[model samples]
Target: MSTDTEALARSATKFAVPESLWNDDVAADLSPPELLLYRSNLLGSDLTVTNFGGGNTSAKLEGVDPLTGETVDVLWVKGSGGDIGSMKIEGFATLYQSRLLELEKHYSGPDDDDKMVGYLPHCTYNLNTRAASIDTPLHSLLPFAHIDHVHPDAIIALAASSEGEAATQEIWNGKIGWLPWKRPGFTLGVMIRDYVKQNPDVQGVMLAGHGIICWADTAKDCYEHTIQLIADAASYLNEKLGDAPAFGGEIVAPNPERRAIAAALMPKLRALMTGDRPKLAHYSDDAETLEFVGSADFERLARLGTSCPDHFLRTKIAPLTLDPERLNDQAYLQSSLEDYRAGYAGYYQRCAGPNDPAMRDANPVVVLVPGVGRITFAANKATARIAGEFYGNAINVMRGAEAIGAYVALDEQEAFNIEYWALEEAKLQRMPKPKPLVGKIAVVTGGAGGIGAATAARLMREGACVMLLDRDEAALDAAAAGFQSEFGKDVIRTAICDVTDEAAVAAAFKSCAVEFGGCDIFVANAGIASSAPFEETTSAMWKKNFDVLAEGYFLTARSAFTLMKQQGEGSMVFIGSKNGVAAANGAAAYASAKAAANHLARCLALEGAAHGIRVNTVNPDAVIKGSRIWDGDWRKERASAHGIDTGKELEEHYRLRSMLKRDVLPADVAEAVYFFASDMSAKSTGNMLNVDAGNAQAFTR
Candidate 1:
């Protein structure tokens, strides 16, 4: 007999969900879709049951499209960033049955969870007109029309228990198929699809410690199955002497004008990073969430995530705690923001990896009011709805678990591992297809200021998760603050790394993963200049210059290639100098090191392509507006040595060179790096692009 049967035989001796229990109405007065949404939202909020961005849910309504007149069927699935509890009609997207089935046939070799959703029909509809949930495919995979996937405390309490799988098998028997937790997304869909196809008679799938999937031909059937299954699990728990402790927590007062609070906070947050305003969602104008946020255990609870993994993707790892004590203090608010950001920095330090995405700015996604209510944050309305639902459910679970024995969620390191795993990090690499650049992690060494800063900024604007690795702590802080001041903190991140050290470089890359989620575009822009004749260019001068330019680039490229290879895709760009191509007098070490850097990039390009990684170099000529190479005494001396006035030399150089006649600028060079870092040059690997404004040809002059 199947393990499920043997377990079922054992469970047969325990209390089961009586057939009559199905007749009792589920509380909360939710419609079929709305009920599923509410339950999912609740589950999404439960840190004891779900992880941030981990789980998904769906409901299917068969209907013929009037536009087609033919039997055109569609399955409305939950799109990514959507949590079921507060999910609205706009949070769902309709995929034609034919398309979902067609997508099933062409199994791309195991892809990331979020990108796997991209393979679904193009989002032709807006969230307002048509929202799409990421779990739509998992729902579509079920034989039944209505399906729900949730991570519940009582349920996972059973799943993660030592006898969990066996217990579930016994209770569920032939009715449920247990699936080991694979990372959710396309691979997950493939796993479920294969299982369902193999076990055609199963009514549900239980994932160990992950959650449970239930389905039925109708919404009611699906709901009944879920409720009964959960009840059965709860019964089993009670039998084992597990009693859900009484809910205990004092409620805080609500903020009367909560909506105004959310609105005023948006611009302040947007000022911290580059992106659209995050959407906001809330429940109970009275603010139960606020009370929950102010609970004595709030700190530990706030940092903790949902019970299962999938919840993290929806609610993030944790919600922002709005302290009641600092309610009216602006300084306190500022300090709160600072504290949150610093905490994120610490989290990055603890959890980041070599290829992880960088941390976006730290902004509150969900605000737990002391007495008022909970508030959800998002870049758009759709995401807010998702946040609100997932967060609300998560808070509810925490509150419930607190009544028993404090919600014991995953540790920071565990959360970090999942958040920065290669597959999940791959989502950071996703860009619009048929585009300029893709699958490249460019690290602009010295990226905290000047051209390095500009290069990092330009790369992100061009769709790369730019990792700014610089030794200048002051520049790093200023750049991070400046970027957060403008972009809202989620897009860009800075690392204080001395690139010459291999260990430091490796650690910095790991931090990049924790900060942004992954690294694909690398710039290697860190370097220093010296203007001395061959005799004056001492051993110290040679070593220092080579350390930054040659050794630094080598370490960075090696790290980038390792991550890219594991991910099966990536790109790297080296910042080479015009002096490297044609020597400049009195700058022997700088020139030679740059030449070595260029060759290093070319060799990487040749080898990286085999692993689906592209490598390239950008040769820039005297484009130094804020560079150490061009400022103060260095500029005048170089100009005098080259036999022309500084201003006149730059002008003559630009004019005497080629047709464009424009002076090379950091932005211009950055644009070249951006092109190679993105899909614009997908097939152009092992290449070198010049951003020298014709000055490359002038080297011969």
Candidate 2:
């Protein structure tokens, strides 16, 4: 061989070793300039595997935010969408480690972005653009000091092949882990989290049909390993297929008409995922305009996955194809839908075995048809993007596979196995975001008092942007203040609303949607209580308590329910009293009102189920904080009237009667309220959870 040819052969052989096996120490001490060089070389190989803005990179450092009291902090996560190969300090967002961890613990409602809160606690981003990369949670999920997420085409090409996973595994040699596709964002991050927990030593993860993730002790190590990882995969591919083939087929052109088609389907698709119309990002007018105005294959092109995995979690496995041939008639569309449903059922039955689990629903994430474009589905804008990514990638892989050896996806049975796998499905149900209610708008009736305040605070913590509705504006403001002090002003809202008035209730519901997008969770927590003999409860006396507790709960819950039903999915909680089940002597009016409210909750649950909404009731025993009936003098007078010691009367009224023998505090009721309002109880509907410290059994006059 010529001397230069001999040198080239040696260099190529040196690059053949698996990169992940390298010790951290080798790249650990590299200077910044050296680190940049390593990053460039690594990315050159991986970049072909990633699409525009498909990945992010970060390096960890211990520091303090000088402007924020010099608190010890985990500063600077790279900005969303910035290329890691040439990332700069400015690309990173500064996050307070303590705050991010704290936010993760905050409970969120089913309707909110728990992931965003989790990300927020760890990263700070540009307030100017108001967008963060969807992969931020992956950064939070990693324990390593550095993190990198990329859609390496070679890695994905290897992973997307019919035997892609097996092929990658041969190269990965158990050092890396694999996550089945899900649309990106919280769901994908969660999938990564579970995998990492099981395989703490995994240096990288392959997102099938999506991308790759690589991390280590430092930036240079992470970047270099990524290079090595991709090179190894490429080598494997080269050995199997010889030289890679050139792009042979006609690329699909973009058509502007595709946007109108996508826009039409988005509304229907969003409701199916979330049971509500979640706030979504605008569709890409640029891409749609280009696609719509350009190509005949635009529909086929839009049917694929995004450049990443979690996009499937958000968008589903594929888009529903809008075939022009089929679209010509309603019957044709109906027939196609029937086939889809049957296919889904068949797929489900084939997958579910004696040991297999069940999911909330078995539905196709996407549908494909010839001629027309695809419609991506999601619960929100973020989810839609994720769904789109998954579909986009799937189309790419399927087409490519056809050229090699006919595109074939995991069979119905195998797909079913994955779709219903316990761990995978559980990602949808894991340690929920504390603020599941964050992006969602909500209203809490009786939000001025203890139960109301506690429930509202709990919802805020979980992520609902709230409108505190009550007649007592000052008290509502005070209650909201306590929550705002802890959570921040953006979370709590207050409005002077008397639940007794239909017009006022209607207005409040309207206000909630207008202020914070739309209402998704409602807490009918406001009420009044008083005791009077059934016969002596005059019309005026009867009307007053009943108006607020019974009629009020009904009115607010009804309006919220109507709005929620229209939105497609929602959750509502009615705060009932233990008196509803075990009546108190001389408390006929209060008990009757609570009983009615409980009934209403059951009815709401049954009706809302069709819309994918959930409704439940929380019944707590008497709480003493700021109760109108429990003023000191009144308590003493009541005890004397009842011929019982005040302490005995109070004790006998609550704690000692229950199995747990503890007072049911406002916070305790709030816990149950939060449970019913969030996804924790996605399958628990129309049920009542008692927060009486086991007081349901003990009752007396």
Quote each prediction's TM-score.
0.45, 0.43
Best by lDDT: 1
How many Å off is the CA of 447 in candidate 2?
1.0
Worst 10 residues of 2 by lDDT: 8-17
Please give, for residues 1-701, the per-residue lDDT of candidate 1 as tens digits. 33422332232122223232323356347665565565555544544334445456666555555556666556666665655555665666667766676676556666456555666655232223453555566776655667777776566655444455666777677778887656455677678878988998887777754678777775556656776777776565555533322123333334455544443343333233323221222233323354455345656677766655655555667766766556556566667667777776788887887767777645656656554456555543334555676665555445434432346565567667676766455655663352232222356788875678788777655444456788889878888787777645545667789989888888887655433334566777887877778988899989998998899889987876765665556678788878878777888988999889988887888788887888887888777576755776667757766667887665576456645776777788877877777667878876667677765453533
Model 1, residue 369: distance off in Å is 30
Where model 1 places Cα greater than 4 Å from the true spot, the runs are 1-441, 646-659, 696-701
Provide the global lDDT of candidate 1 against the true structure. 0.62
User: Candidate 2 lDDT, tens digit per residue, 1-701?
Assistant: 33522332222111122344334566588764345434533553333444434566655566646566564646345455455555554555656555654554543532234435444633452232323455566776667777777665456665566666666667878888887766455556667877988998788888765678888876656766776786777566445433332122213333325444443433333333432325532233232222221234434444332333433434444444545444445465555556655655665676687766654444445544332344433333334344444455444444333323323344344345445655455556664553465446567887877777777777777666678998987877788778878977655667799888989887777656434445678888887766666777778867887898888988888878776775678888888878887767776777888888888888888889998889988888757655534654546644654667777567575566577877777888889988887778888888888887776453322
Provide the lowest-lDDT 10-residue window in model 1. 8-17
